[model samples]
Target: MIRTLQSGQQCQVRIASVTGESTLLYSTHRILLEAPNWTLDGRSLILNGDGKLWRLDITSGTLIEIPLGGIPDLNNDHVLAPDGESIFLSANDGHIYRAPLTGGHAQRITPDDGSFHFLHGVSPDGAELAYVGIGGGDFRQPGRLMTIASDGGAPARVNVGEGHCDGPEYSPDGKWLYLNTESFSTEPGHAQLARIRVDGTGFEQLLESKTVDWFPHLSPDGQYASYIRFPSGTQGHPADLPVAVVLVSTGDWKTPLHTWPLFGGQGTLNVNSWSPDSEHFAYVAYPPATQTED
Candidate 1:
């Protein structure tokens, strides 16, 4: 189901620089926006709201809808294609679609194999995609790491373990798929940052923490990463929570270089939002409107 802001709540679009500065790019109470994707040219940010795609021009602050044909309402799971002119979208109908960035007919990529496809990353070479598949659309079943050709084919499962995982994004070098998984913990919903080889070997946990982490997105240059940290006992990345977006050096993921505390989850930093230059990344925040002194 598409989620909306409750009365008196507001959505904020923000960018955080690796050098430790934060900027509020835009905000609204009219609609709930989430999961920003920085365009390859660094001129705009792509976001989704009300089951549709929107592009926000950073310089002019113009927000426009990118129309799509032959696709269901979109979810927060979307990734920019490596080509810079197209995107891969995971619609609410349990299928992934490819559409031009300029907006046009969306070509369905998943083969309807009785699994729900949630898109995360496109390979650096643009030949493959990494995502999480929920078998038979069952929430009770653990999600499995999946990969498929960018043009569409039978998806292959990359075994990390028998646990729920999400945000299987490719490292900028095309060697590792970064994600958060429950395999490291016996505690339910205790997803920790992890990475596995594209060939399905060398699975390693990146960090150890009581906080439930989700979505470890690497910068385009592969120097830094950003992820959302939920409360210790939070289950399944729920919305409207007090979450923190932590930035860390890829070489030493244990120590945080910076952290931005905000009121959002689920839709905040679910995808890679790093600018092409890798200097800045974007995210969303949903906070209640402040009471006015009338």
Candidate 2:
């Protein structure tokens, strides 16, 4: 059974597995739903819609709203903590929060700093949080990759070149944090995939190309990494575009084991969504709505 809201999204939401099977899990007609994070048990998916969060049961295809009382301005930037006990969310106000996985009052982790913080991933041991921080309302400016204590404290900037750094994910072992950086806001096409240490050192470039690459998620088994690539000259990964999800061998796995074309870019797979077994991952696709004769 495919569920849809009558007013919000321009298209429908789909759960596409790596085995090439895609299903219409949910949709909204009034509010746009974006960004999905998989559960550690692989039984459900948690996503944000209308400034609130929802849990979608993978087996029953049911949608349940998580009661986020205090955090009314939640964004798509969220990830399940490694402990599988709590969830961290980046609200629209640019502050980070920790809440119960089942949903409740969220505790703000970052202070009321002027800079905006959008969370990318939580450390393996769930102690550090890596995110991109920058001045608010100016999306064109390059962002800095930084980390903070998961509980709440001053943030330390990761040692990366001055550029637009985003989509920071930690390796399973908590040694390397993978991220993408592009020099100058003028040349957005130069985005390259790279990884650095949690202490802000030992940085190395992983992949570089003319095409813009964003959101690289390593598999749970520590064998492969998957990410999304955008077309030439696109900035900030605009929505409703042709994109491909590429899978690469992490530790001598291989290069480009699989890449699938889809119709979503920015909010498709912003968080670590690999399943527990490491066989297939989950991603959302926004397909175009049927043309109505206007």
Question: Against the true structure, what is every candidate's RMSD?
Answer: 1.9, 4.1
Model 2 over residues 1-294: C-alpha lDDT tens digits? 112433333544565555655567665555566777889988988888777888888888788888876764787789899988789999888888999998789998987677889999898889999998986647667788889999999988886888788889899898889887775335845677888887777877787666788888998878888888888687776677888878788854236777778777867878887877887777776666642111
For model 1, which pairs clash? none
C-alpha lDDT score of every prediction, in listed order:
0.94, 0.78
- Backbone collisions counted per model: 0, 9
Worst 10 residues of 2 by lDDT: 1-10
TM-score, prediction 1: 0.98
- After superposition, candidate 1 runs with Cα above 4 Å error: 290-294
TM-score of each: 0.98, 0.89
lDDT of 1 by residue, 1-294 (tens): 998998998888998999988888888889899899999999999999999999999998789999999999999999999889999999999999999999999999999899999999999999999999999999999999999999999999999999899999999999999999999988999999999999999999999998999999999889999999999999899998889999999999999999998888979999999999999999998887763211
